[model samples]
Target: MTSSPPGLDLDALRKHLDDALPGLVAGPLDAAVIAGGRSNLTYTVTDGATTWVVRRPPLGHVLATAHDMGREHRVMAALRGTAVPVPAMVHLCSDPDVLGAPFYVMEHVDGAVLRDPESLRALGPERVRNLAFRLMDTLAALHAVDPAGVGLSDFGRPDGFNARQVSRWRRQLDGSRSRELPGIDALHERLAATAPELSAASIVHGDFRLDNTVIDTGRGDRVAAVLDWEMSTLGDPLADLGLYVVYLGTPMPAARGSHDPVTTVPGHPATGELISFYAEKSGRDVGGLGWYTAMSAFKLAVILEGVHYRYTQGKTVGAGFDTIGARVQPLVDRGLAALPREKG
Candidate 1:
């Protein structure tokens, strides 16, 4: 008899699965929290012989238009055979009565999530470099997928996407302003004033990075699955690349016990090289990334602010949240520094 993890009711989940997916639960359920996710709450649940991953919103202070279960399920379900590898969706429970919040279950992907420099270093430089390029190639493949072809023509509005991102993140900042974030407002204003024209619209994974994916080291360092699609939408593809670079540049705080940034690892490709490779692979202009990088920083800063707010309210579900607040200001500064000298 295993006790349920926080924010998940094992009995409720078991009952729902029994009703919706008959005979799926062979035995009583056991669940545990999956760390490393700073935004959505992820859990691994097992019923003796079978296992699956479950994603749900945070406990309290969930922002509007965020942590959408249906959106996450739809995009992944539609991308089953595409070049972009995603976990197989099992079921989506929108009836909050099951988990107190909408949640979806998916097959548990088996692979390594190279989140720290030490993990990347262990692979030696060659494998690390291959993995990085594979990531870039995967992003390009995702960008190459046509929305209308995948029945996602209405996934999002691509026109004025950058402008909407600026306004949306600003509103997100407002929704979670527990403390003053210096330079955040100025960054937002700068982003609003200089939002670039779309550099080509594609299925943008709002948070694209190495850790956000599961690498199948057994398969010659192939990407087994790309996780964390909570922010996926039809928008500027450069936005994904910009955030990927930001992750490469930014390291987690020491207090959080995370290792150095992945960029410092030997064999990791240079930022410029990766960007150029994406340009060559995707056939889209990679110019004017400076503005896109700044926009990514602003978006990340607001996201961390939301997490910090939830931590303050004691609504966060896992560890590593104490230091999240410390990362917000630096992101704000990065956004300001990366802004183009002249608006595009």
Candidate 2:
């Protein structure tokens, strides 16, 4: 008898797959949870020889609008032949009865998620430098993709996206405010007052960072796939750039473990270099990057605050979220500081 995993009902899943797509799984399945806390719950399942990954919403108190597996699966499927490297989507199940929530399956791509500076340092400065530039280049490629060409013309409303993002985040913050966060509102107001003119609407990976991507260390250290697309939409491409820049400079919290701050690492190009490189590569003027950067900061602060709220409610799984809230104020401050200079 094959026992179910902590977060998955193996028997039901196997049965569902067998009925949906026969001969996919030969026999029983073994499953284990992948440690990505405070968001979606990921599982690795194997049926003797074949391995696959499954993504679902958190255990309880999920924000329905935020964790849409169908949306993630659709974007990955749409970018199948594009420059953006995404996992091979296998199947999508929307019937909540199957595994208690909607879930999707994809081929498990083997790679490392370089989280902290120490891990990046071990790979040496040369590799880190290459990875950083590659990261920028990848974003450029994504921005350059034609939505209509890729069957994603209606994926999101690009018109007034910046304003919508600002309003959307404000509502999210209000819903998740467990404690007082000084200057958060002021930062939001400032960002709203000076939102930049929207660039061409492109697929924005709401959270694009080094850690969110999987790097294949052996295959010339290239990005294997871009994961976690729950916040993705058709928006100003610079919004993605702004968030990436904030992640580059924000200090990793002690309680909530940090990924290698690749931008700070030696040989890795400075934030300015990245911005310029992206501008040159994409042919998009980035004079208003400072505003976007401030918006990014505000956006991230709201996200972390939500995570902290979930943590307080005992709704979060895994570690790192204990001190996640502690990082919110600093992010708010950083966003405010970025407003005047508007520099990346």
Candidate 3:
């Protein structure tokens, strides 16, 4: 588990906000960096009474195109009528004069991203299963949402998404200093050969899974909000489905290995169960998802390799520093295996 950043003073935030907004009650705000997450610096802020969450770029060198808080805010606003639950977006400050970089404020959702064993015990097996199912349902709901209805017809193009994805990621990986990974190339070729048929354009939560979703574990463990829109884009929704299966099914154990054996995965749901649950909820066929899974595996490998590269270059923050970055090879291998074999 990652710890919040230390030494953040509320007085500084209060001063900054009061100077920026003028009349709105700002703070006696306490800012704590929520750890375990990469890509953004998430802080829990309070205005002496009401609480809000703010996200900004991490303290490091970032690509000019990445970490667009404006894109995040806009997506949240456009997803209003969608079945995906999103916290009410409060304010967006692009002017660096406010917080040193672009940032946004939104209604702080009360829930857990980290799994609590005790809390899981209270929720019991049925509710725990419900929690897992709800996440799948929400993703399906997001797919069902019409981008036109939400003023997002231009959000992204789903046309030829599967066909285009192969080249796009390969290009990104190729530009980096990392050695040519066969698994990545192999998976890319396989996906290109067996790309699935495209479907309707839907809101693709680039990252969606248990941790990205805030499940209100009260009487009913409902997903309060699907957070993290930094990578959200319009494209094939199956790509999203494929990612959930990879993280929940393939990556977790492969990530842990035999390093720790006593770990109990609560509700302890597996990938097949969740994917099936999603298919039922979304009314989509699951028979032809090999490409999606393979795509997910290659995508994760590229992402982790990028993390490895950034860490090696000393461009990332402390918690992101890990030997896990070195494991990109196995991810690629597994991803390649996930794809369907070509017919002879």
Candidate 4:
């Protein structure tokens, strides 16, 4: 018999699912926590015949605006017929009584989430190159989506999105402040002082990256589904592109051990190529990306800092968090460097 993972009540979950869907569970539900997520706690729940993925907030110290289950559910549900690939949202439980926090269930997508250089290498250079381009194309397709058409016109305030992002992330950093993050404040100040004008409002995946997507390895390495939509909203599309570039450039510390930076992987397209490809595919001007990239760095740093805060409070549910705090400063440094110099 398998015991329930921390923060998830299997018996209660089984009851809720059955009550909501009726005859969804055929046997006793068993669940195991899935690794890789640093913010939300993800689990794979099964009842012998079927499996599903459950997403909920961190056990403790969750930021007010982050980790919203309803927002995630709504965006994915709205994007079902769009070019963006998202898991089929099954049920969204707003009542926290069922789970300690609001949680949502979606069909388990079968594919690979390539996180490390080794995994990309396994696919060989040609496949890796093709996969990288496809990921960019997918991102273009997402930015091309009309939020109002998808019932998400009010998903987020697009006007002044960048300015609000700077303020919002600064507040987020304040909420998660446990230790002094050198240059982080300065980076934020620079971002605030030089916030770029909105460069086209569209649906932005707040945390878009290659790892957040599931690749259908059996189907020519195509993206099967895009996961982790907690931060999806209407905003400047360049913000999404900027964050993707940061992920490509940054060397993320693995949970167990470090791997080569994503850019070092064989056949991975250069940053310039990917940016140009997006511009051509999306027809959005790629100018002034430095500001967006710097802002993305600051945003990412705050996110990691929040995770660090949770880890310090023993609220985190998995490995890899120990190394998260250390990465914050580097991101800050990168952001500062990416900022455009003031006019003389």
Q: Pick by lDDT: which candidate is best?
A: 4
Pairs of residues clashing in candidate 1? none
Ranking by TM-score: 4, 1, 2, 3
For candidate 3, write residues 1-344 as lDDT tens digits.
Answer: 22334323345456656776676554355556665555676887766788888888765555555578998999998886567789898888787655567888788899876333444456677777667777777888899988888888887778988787777777657655456666576677777777776865677887776667787776377888888898777888888998877766533322223332112445656667777888888888887777788888787777677666766776665463576465678778877778766679
Candidate 4, position 182, lDDT: 83
CA lDDT of each prediction against the hidden true structure: 0.90, 0.85, 0.71, 0.90
Q: What is candidate 2's lDDT per residue for 1-344, written digit by digit as tens?
A: 76775557998899999999899998689988776444788888999889999998877766548889999999999998899999999999999999999999999989988777776777888988898999998999999999889999999999999988898999888888778889898888877887666777888989988878899999999999998898988989999999999998975432123444556677788999999999999999898888888899998998888888888888776667777887889899999998894456
What residue pairs are clashing in model 2?
Answer: 115-259, 115-260, 116-259, 116-260, 117-260, 290-342
Candidate 4 backbone clash number: 0
Per-model TM values vs. the true structure: 0.97, 0.94, 0.85, 0.98
- lDDT, candidate 1, 133-177, per-residue tens: 999999999999999999999999999999999999999989988
Q: What lDDT tens digits, residue by residue, belong to model 4 across residues 111-154?
A: 99887787888899899999999999999999999998999999
Better of 1 and 4 by lDDT: 4
Find the candidate with the highest TM-score and give its number.
4
At residue 340, candidate 4 shows an lDDT of 74
TM-score of 1: 0.97
Worst lDDT 10-window in candidate 2: 251-260
Residue 326 C-alpha lDDT in model 1: 86
Candidate 1 regions exceeding 4 Å error are 252-259, 342-344
The per-prediction CA RMSD against the true structure, in angstroms, equals: 1.8, 2.6, 4.0, 1.1
